[model samples]
Target: MMPLVHSLSADDEIFSVSVSHDGTRVAASYNDAIMIWDTHTGCRTLGPLKGHEYWVWSVAFSPDGRSLASGSSDNTIRIWDTETGTELLEPLNQHTDEVTLVLYSYAGTFLISGSDDHTVNIWDPYTGNLIGPPIDTGDRVSSVAISPDSTKIAIASFNNTLRIYDFATVSPILHDFTIHVCDAATGISIGNPFRGHTNVVTSVAFSPDCRYIASGSDDMMIILWDAVTGQICAEPLAGHSSGISAVVFTSEGSLLVSGSRDHSIKVWDVGAVIRRVELANGSNSIVTQRIDLEITSVMSLKDVVSRLTDWGCTDMSAELDWTSVGDYPISQGGFGDIYRCKLTDGHEVAVKTLRVYVDPDEQTRKSLKHAAREIYTWSKLKHPNVQPLLGLVVFREQVGMLATWEPNGNLPSYIERNRETDRCLLGAQIAEGLAYLHDLGVVHGDLKGVNVLVSKDEIAQLADFGNAVLREYTIQFSKTSTKHNISPRWTAPELFRGSKYSMEADVYALGMV
Candidate 1:
C-alpha cells in the first residue's frame, strides 16, 4: 500500500535515513521501528521490521546493497537482509551501553559499532562473534572510521582528542626499520617496534620543525615516521618510480624534499601530505584525496644542481681533477664507493658513488635511481659531528652525493695509525653525536668504528646510515635465521637471531665501540 508522504513525514519523526548504494531503496528509523521504502514510489516496501526494545538511533546499508545494519538505545545492534526484510540474527549483545552508530566496511566483510560503553568492536555480521580485542575508546565514542586501506581506524570521542589505531596486526618485521622504545632508567624495553616500512631502511632524517621522521628504503618508497609513537604518519609517498636515496625537510620545515636514483628531486608539502594521510586513515569508505599541496615540484638532477648553485652551494666543477681523486675508495661496506676529491674552491670533499656495471645509455632510468639510493641522505645533516655534505650531482656515468673530507679517517684506522693516545675526547665526541641522533629519533643503522670518522680537531662524526641494517642480504634474503647482518663481536645477542635494527641495537654498538 502507498503511504501518504504527508502522513509519513508529519505523524512520524524519523531519527536517521540511509539510501541503498543502487538508489533503489531507503531505510529510515521511525519511532522504534524502521520503514523501508521504494525511493521513487514513496511506498513503504518493508518494516516496521521491529525487534528493538527502545528507540532506534542509527542505520547503514552494507556495501553490496543487500544488508542493513542498525543500532539503538536498547543497547543492541542488528543486521537485516534487505531482500526479504529478514533479521540476520539475534541482536549482538557485547556492548553494555547504548549503540550510537553502526557502519560497514567496504567489502562487507565486517561491521563496526560505536557505543556509550566507551569501546568499538568489530563483528562478524554472519556469526555475531567479535573479532580481535575490543578497542577501548577511553570515553564515549561518538564516531569511528576505518581507513581506505583497512589498516587503521580513527575514533572521535568525548575526551576532545582523536585517537588512531592500526587495525593491522603486528608481525616480526625483520626486513623493515622499526623504532623500538626502551626505558632510560632501567635499560629494559618498553613496547613493540613502530613497524610500517616494507623494505630495509637505507636512510632516516628528522624534519627540522615538525614531529615527523622520514625514512628512505630500497622499496623505493618514502615513509613519514611519527616521532612520538614510531608509527607511520601517512601513506607511502610514490612518485619516484625507484628507491629513494635521500630525504630532508627544507629550512622552514614546511616542505620536504626527496632525491631518487631516478635522478629527480621531488618537493612535498608536509602538512598537506599528513592531512591526506589522516583522511585516508579515517575510513575505508572514504575515497583517497589527491591534493596539489602534497606535491609542489619534480625536478631533474641538472635542475637541482643549478638551483643549489644559484643559492650558493659552491662550485665543484674544477674538482674533476683526476689527480685529486683518491687512489682507492676509503672502504666498501655500507653502500661503499668513496673517493677523495678537491673542489674548485680548494676544499677537499669525498664523493660517494654506487658501482653499477650497467651502461648508462642502455639502462632504464629506474635502474639508475636504485643505484643512487645509498648516498642521498647526506645533504640534510649539519651537526658538527655529522657527516658534512656539500651537494648531490647526477652524471651520465656516475651519479652521487658529495661530503666534506675527513682527513683523520675512520676512528678504528685513526686510532690504529696514531697509537693509544687515550682517545677519550674522540669517544666523548662520538657519544655526543649519538645523543644528537637519538634525540632526533634516528638510528645510525650502521654504527661501527669504521663508520665513525674523526676530524683534524679530534671530534668524531657518524657516517654510513644505509648500513644500519642489511640492505642487500642476497643469499639469506628470506631465510629466517638467528643471525642478522650485524657483526657478532659488537652486536647485542638478541639481534643475533636475524632481527631488525632498533635504537637499542645502535646503543649496543656504541658500547662495543
Candidate 2:
C-alpha cells in the first residue's frame, strides 16, 4: 500500500519502522537519521534525530521508552535521549565495520549489537561499557534477537545461516528462527508467518482464546486468522478506508480494535464482519482532508499490566495503584524487593517486586522463570497451610506478586517472640504445605523457617516461592561455583554438589527446620 505520508526523494527510502513497547511512539529509519512520530497524531514528535553521518541501519526503543538506540554505517552506535533528541556522549565504537543491529534486552538492562565485522558485542548501555568479549559469528551479521526468556541469543547472518548461543552451555547452534510451528518433541517448524494482506500489514494480534489471529492492513480491512489451519477463518472486517497501522484485542478476545492513518479506532466483535464502535481523537469520529477518510488509534488500557498480557484476561496480574506500595521495603534480596502493600480490595499483602537485571548468568535466569511460573500457578493452589497468591499488581513500571498478608510476621520472628510455645504445630503446617506441593511434582527446595509465615490465626503458612522457582527452573552452574542464595545452614549437604531436588531434599530441610 502507498504510504499516506511521502517524501520527495524515494531513493532515500525508509528501510525500517518500529513502534515503542508501550505503543505510544513510532520510529522509522531514513538515510542519515532516525525519525520519531506520535502514533496517535501521526505527527513528528522528535527527529530527524541526526547524529549518524551515513545511513542509519537499525533503531530500537528501550522497553521503558526512556531512550532510543541506533546503529549506523558510520561504524559506531549512538544512543539518544528520547525527550530532547540529544546524542549520548562517547559513542560505542567497538566494531571494525559498520554496525547493523542494536537491541535492548527484554527488560531494558543491556544493549547488544551485531555488525558487518562478523561479531556480536554486548554493552552495558548505562555505563557504555562492553560486558564481555564479542562472539565472532564468522559472517556479516544481519540481525540479532534475544530469546523471550533472555537466556539465549540468535543471530541471522549474511551467509544464509542462523546462529544460536546459549548462556548456560557456552555452545552455539547454527539454524533457527523463521517463525515455524515447531513440533513439541522433534523441534521443527511446521507453521510460518501466514501471509495474505495486499498492502502493508500495519498491525497484528492474537485472540485471547488463541484460536484466531487478527491482522489490520493499509488495504482498509481486518482479517481473522484460523490459527489451527494457518488460513483466513472469518470474513474480512472492512470499515476504515485508509490503511490500518495498529490492532489489539481486549482481555477476553470478545472485541478487537484497529487504528489507521485516516485517524480512527474501530472496535469489532470477534465473529462479526463489521465495526462495532469507532472512536477518534478530539472527537468521536475523525474527518481527514480527503473528506471520505477518517481513523482512530489504539489506546492504553487502564491497567498497565494489560499492556503485556491483554490476551490472557484471566492472567494472575491485576491493576494496583503505586500508592499501595509501602514507603519502606520489608526485605530485599539479590533478585527482588518485598513490600507490605494494600490492594484495591482494601486488604494487605506481601509484595515482591522482581529485580530487573541484564546479562544475568544462567542461574539468575532460571530463578526468574521458575519464580514467575510459580507465581502464575499459585492462584490455583488452595490449602490453609500454603499461602494463596492473591494476584499481581503492575503499575508505574513496578511489578509485584501479592500474596496472603500474614500480620503475625514470619515463623522465625514468631518463634523468637514466643520462645516458650512448642513449635510442632508450625512444623506440621509446613509439612502439610510440602505434602501438597510434592503431590504436584513440585520441590520447595528452600524450606527455612524464614520462608514460612505466621498468619493472623497463629497458623503457619509456607511463603516465598523464590527458591521454589529456582528448583523448578533447575539452575545450571559450573562445578567450581559454590556461591548461591540457598540457606547453607538449612540446606542438605548433598544439595551443594548439584543433587536433583527431591522429596528427600525437602524432607531434610523440614527435619532441620
TM-scores of the models, in the order given: 0.36, 0.43
lDDT of 2 by residue, 184-265 (tens): 2333555665666676664566665566677776677877776667776555777665676556654434445555555444
The clash tally of candidate 1 reads 11
* Worst lDDT 10-window in candidate 1: 1-10
Q: Against the true structure, candidate 1 has what lDDT? A: 0.62
Residue 396, model 2: lDDT of: 33
Kindly provide the TM-score of model 2 when superposed on the true structure, using C-alpha atoms.
0.43
Q: What is the C-alpha RMSD of each candidate to the true structure, in Å?
A: 26.9, 22.9
Off by over 4 Å in 1: 1-323, 326-330, 356-376, 419-422, 468-486
Q: Estimate, for each residue in 2-93, the C-alpha lDDT of model 1 and write its tens digit.
A: 11111123124455556565444567675577777653334577877788899777788887788899999899999998888889888898
Global CA lDDT of candidate 2, please?
0.62
Off-target runs (Cα >4 Å) in candidate 2 are 1-12, 167-180, 183-187, 191-227, 233-513
> What are the lDDT figures for the candidates, one per model?
0.62, 0.62
